[model samples]
Target: AKVVASPIELCQFNGISRRDKTAQQKPMIEVISSTDFQVLSCINQIKQNMFLQFPERRLIQYDCGKLQTLDVLLAQLKREKHRCLIFTQMTKMLDILELFLNYHGYTYVRLDGTTQIVQRQMLMERFNSDEKIFVFILSTRAGGIGVNLTGADTVIFYDSDWNPTMDAQAQDRCHRIGQTKDVHIYRLISKNTVEENILKKANQKRLLGDLTIDGGSFDVNYFKKNNIRDLFDQSSTLEDIVRERNEYQQKLDTSRTTIAVAATKTTTTTTITNSSNPDSNLTLTQYEEALAAVEDETDRRAADELNKEVRNE
Candidate 1:
């Protein structure tokens, strides 16, 4: 299971955490530098730091961005006729993707915060019955957990969630008790940004969850006198433990990135020599070469990510 995000700086990120907001300060400054738009969306001046508002606003266009990542993945899935679950934290993200998927002619069902609890089951049942419905769009927090849709053999996180546990639960929507085929999970992360850091943190949290639940035996200190206090003393408070754990996790993630990059390093560029037409430059072979180069880059990145997953295991 993985956490995914399509980062193209397309959305007005609302209610961002202080740490992440601070990390994106430079990009926000760039946006301010380029445009004359003053943010007016946040009511309280002091509290309105995370969002950028303008008189007229536009998200980064879908092509050549994260949507392109989805296009490639979804195409292969369509060829195999594999059912899919596409999960995102934001309904607005779902709205945009719905448009993209519909334009591509995929039949899909959706569930979000607005869907009533009573109607949720009915929608899931509808999706389950119709094999022709190839996709399910779900808001991760609202409808990801407890809903069983084993029809889909693929689970994709359109964006990462702050809570690692929620992301894991979202994956379980497809990897449920009665699934017959092997499930494939893809987390589409933007390269070289705060989004990458965020995913590292989430994966570390996932590792912690695994350590807590996994393993064969408990430590001797767990049986010591003042057992409850001893437990608290061993790690301090739960909050403190989490804080210390995250502080230690950063070092581990650094090394993991080093290993992943080392193991999956590949050439992503090629020199195309076209001398067929002296007068003009554009040709079918050249166009195909450009597309292949883009695909090669995408595949290289995916392979690198898969290597990371293997190491994580």
Candidate 2:
């Protein structure tokens, strides 16, 4: 009979229990009597089956205790020559992991909220083409959408987001239409941490309400209580702010586009009216265009001034 090791036992085997005398480390292993090992075994078998059936993609959740276990998994993936994407809710945590990976001589690409649009496109291209870059560290909020990352067949959620939908969105980035191989998702949830509790609450809330709020009438107190600032706040977790901000920004962009289109139409109508009705009183379109031109100039000046104020802030 094949012996299946417990998570704690696996951690110990990975050298997670070895400690430095000078630095204090949290107990790397925790006993979970309630954990269903039989179910896990069955699930593992199912995963293997799905891997065969789908042969193109698979999703699996690994609820393990120690980070070292993740290191071990990554090592196995490296040996198998698997390209992977890792999603994190915190940019700070993403940075820390990037640094750790770099120190360990792992070649990876990191993309977060601070990454510019052009830079993001460049990184995506590199990730797709460069076999040397086996890992892509992504901030869930910034790098989650609007990019095709079919090159990677595996996605690891280093931590759970409040909303499972957010996690799904991140995973779909890899498992989308273009992906040819079986994609596997590994969700690492620390056994009894706030991370687990947060997931439960978020999932419950999702069942009650929508996964995210629509464009208008958000609660200001919620932001205050959470210490969230405009989706890009360092203090707020990437999942909490970025999704909402991205949706809002999309709405704003659409509104701006509509306004610009309307303005152009008004200008064209005015030009046509001026040519046709030479001696008649100026048409409404002509008046509207002149008004719009003045408004546009005023808005541009106001935006520049507002930008200066924001820079000072």
Candidate 3:
């Protein structure tokens, strides 16, 4: 199951974190930099003093919700003696994670785009041979392809990729042959962000693939061009998505029940007609009429039941 980790920025501020906000607002300061030299100079001096006191404090936000969630998850996985592979898209994130692991005293091996090809193989071998290594940190694009890390049973996606298949390929590392354990996969998604939409789109793509492979009927326009805009839509919350899914499921269930009842009724009617008149033959038109009648009856009955429930509510 994909576990969404609500990032601290989105959770605490109800928006992007302070650091991100500051970055966005920093560039605008250039426009007014010369106009207020004295005030800017004073502010810069104070900011420098604060930075000196707390070096890289703003750079390394160790107190985020996602990291907090990761800490707890790692602790639990540690207790179970499980080895984990943590994959992130950015190499900079790997640097932060390395510091985090170091702070927590976790024995981990890392691989990213910067690492040499020879070093990559050696690191993989060492991780596979060494039982002391608790975690393997990797850059998703660099570590996603052409390497096997079956030594780890747990995979954590620190961030999602635009192409879902990249994440799937990364997961296939542990799921390869010679793996004895049941692999657990976790995907951390920031709430009310583009990550949520990315996940939904990934799921839709996977569903489309499954349908195509299984010879299921689907609309050709299901992947229409206009639907691409949904990836950037952040207006819908996770709760809204969950509620919509539940409603869709309920409707699907009701539809299945109605179809089943209609089919049974039509079959019974056909059987009775055949039994009552030995010489009677049911034509295709008659069969269609009977099916249509039962479908209408079933729909009416289902609607009445729904109306009664609504009244009771």
Q: Best candidate per TM-score, number?
A: 3
Report the lDDT tens digits of candidate 3 across residue range 162-259. Answer: 55666887899889988888999998888988778767765555543442212223332333333456767888777775676566556656755765
Range of the 10 consecutive residues with the lowest summed lDDT in candidate 1: 220-229
How do the candidates rank by TM-score, highest first? 3, 1, 2
TM-scores, all models, native as reference? 0.49, 0.46, 0.57
Candidate 1, number of clashes: 0
**lDDT per residue as tens, model 1, 1-313:** 8955444232334556556766889788888866644444334563544333321112323544678878888999999999999988666777777777767888998887677657889988888888999899987766623588888899998877644776776898788898899999988766554455455545554554443212223221111122212323332333443576677677667745654464466433322233443444444345334434654343334334433544576
Whole-structure CA lDDT of model 3: 0.70
lDDT of each: 0.64, 0.62, 0.70
Summed backbone clashes in each candidate are 0, 5, 0
Answer with 2 or 3, whichever has the higher TM-score: 3
